[model samples]
Target: MSAAADFAQDRDTLHFRGDLSLARLGSLPDQLDRFDGRVSRVDLSAVSRIDTVGAWVVHRFAARHNAQVEGLDEDSQMLFDHVVGAEQPVAQAPARPNGLIRFVAEVGAAAVQAGRTMYGLLGFLGATTIAFLNVIRHPSRFRFNATVQRFEVVGVSALGIVGLMSFLIGMVIAQQGAVQLAQFGAEVFTINLVGRLTFREMGVLMTAIMIAGRSGSAFAAQLGTMKLTEEIDAMRTIGVSPVEALVLPRVLAAVLMMPLLAFYSCMIALIGGGVLVWLDQGIPPATYIQRIREVVPITDLYIPLIKAPVFGAIIAVAGCFQGMLVESDAEQVGNRTTAAVVQAIFMVIVIDAFFAVFFTWVGWV
Candidate 1:
């Protein structure tokens, strides 16, 4: 039968009695943890037998109290010495900071990350500018065939969906404007509302959003895949400038086609609004068209034509920047593609707002 381990303190010495083996440890380890008193010495004379585990516990308790360990047999003394030599403190997890501190730290980290992202994007823009300059200097470096293919991909292929969305959006706007204007006996003004809104803002804005999601994501995914396959690396090795070969063609196509797409979107939206006007207000399509011509100024057309190419450039640049940043795996390609769409859309909206304010200030409102 094994004797249970026990401990007591007296004469400023902690005495451990009974068999101090691991099986008999019981609550002694815990008691040692809770033990409090002046301990000048550890008396294990009464300890019947001790295992390595028991020797470790005794040695630790003695060290914690800075007490001298005494009354050990030769074997126990050797075991205690080994335990002492082997002792090493374990690493503990850091304590958590309070909420306010953590919040500040997180915000600071996010701000720093955003600054870095802006810096990288600006750097990429500068590099693209230099590449474009080089292409201008050597017109033969301009890849006309690649630009043609990208035109089909980014512009022509997107026409159906973009046109359909514009039509539906225009119908909704006309119907809603008609409903509100009917209350004022000004239902005819729905023509002006739909015409001016679509031509000046919604046409290009919605097209930009669509392009960011469709073509921007495609750019990121395509470039990301090329990077993953090391094809971009191979091209670089062969003296091919990826910016000119890949990025420029996409960027040029987007810039050239955006105006055309926006114009198409505006016309389709006008037709959609004309249809709604005829059905809802019993106004004839010709009359609705005439009213739109009278109410919507030439300045309305200037806005989209001015903004479309910039929006296109922003979308392409954002997509290519995110794509170039992608690394490691297919998962990162998907992530960068998502980031590209979000960044492109966000920038488009922000830039559009600034343009709106500027146009208003310039009396184009």
Candidate 2:
């Protein structure tokens, strides 16, 4: 309970020893008042048994006089650091959340974020639709050259990848079908299976997936970069609508190219399937062609062809929307681009499911 504090002073330093108690807190202000803001350093290494109130007294004394204090014991130093550090205040250990509670909280947060994203997507879609309507009304302002360039980037650039994938898929389907059909003594039916599936589903789905990975990512990256650089804002500052200047051309290109790409994929897949059937199943080209003609009706071919453009539109719009939404730095561009592709593919599958149900109701499936 002793309040005695021994002190030694030099030109600029003050040294303290002995116990500092709570009762001396009132005098600390007076003690610092004598210094006249001139004391540069105070050393307190010799102090012992300081309580929380005593620590507060020391902290206030140092801060009010704007003098540096050193040589404090661990607890007092911690108190000093807490009062002086410019960073965030030190927090005591918090109780850990229960595992299930933590998980539910995380899920709820994710769901809220996802809902916001979906709302943003819907708004973008509405804006894009209005822009398209405007372009339709005033065709003179639409840049056909830019649209064509977008087509080349989205469509022509994807040809090699689409072709390779379709070919490999066709070969796999044909080989598998041939193996299974061999047991049924109907090896020639492999042609029909490969042809029908390739035309009806594989071609359109594979093309959409490929474009989602390629053109979708490109759109997001390009738009995200533009957004990051404020080029989108600059475009808005002028009379030009960003939707018309940026989105419309890309959307038009994707819609125009997807059907053609799907058709090309179908042809390549059929050819590859035919090759597999001819080599593995020992089916001649003419007989294989006859089997395909017998099994695959015109509706089967038309169904996927119709779905291709819709899938392409979904991918283009999703990519553009994600790009426009990016707010972080350049690193976020890749993340948004990935998100765009994944969402586009997911939408494609959902759309395909609807198409499947429709086709089934119409007796096409």
Q: What is the per-residue lDDT of model 2 for residues 1-365, given as tens digits with 9 covering 90 to 100?
A: 65475566787777776666665545554675575645677888878656666666666666766768888867788876775564356788999899999999999999999899889888998998999999999999798898989988998888899999999999999998888888989877788789889988889998999999999999999999999999999988988999999999999899989999999999899889988878876778888788888898999889877999899899999999999988879989999999999999999999998998998998986
TM-score of 2: 0.78
Off by over 4 Å in 2: 1-89
lDDT of each: 0.93, 0.86
Of the candidates shown, which would achieve the greatest lDDT relative to the real structure?
A: 1
Number of residue pairs clashing in candidate 1, backbone atoms closer than 3 angstroms, sequence gap of 3 or more or interchain: 0
Q: What is the lDDT of residue 238 in candidate 1?
A: 100
Query: Worst lDDT window (10 residues) for model 2?
Result: 24-33
* All-Cα superposition RMSD per candidate: 4.8, 8.3
Residue 58 lDDT (model 2): 67
Candidate 1 regions with alpha-carbon error over 4 angstroms: 2-22, 26-104
lDDT per residue for candidate 1 within 225-274, as digits (tens), equals 99999999999999999999999999999999999999999999999999
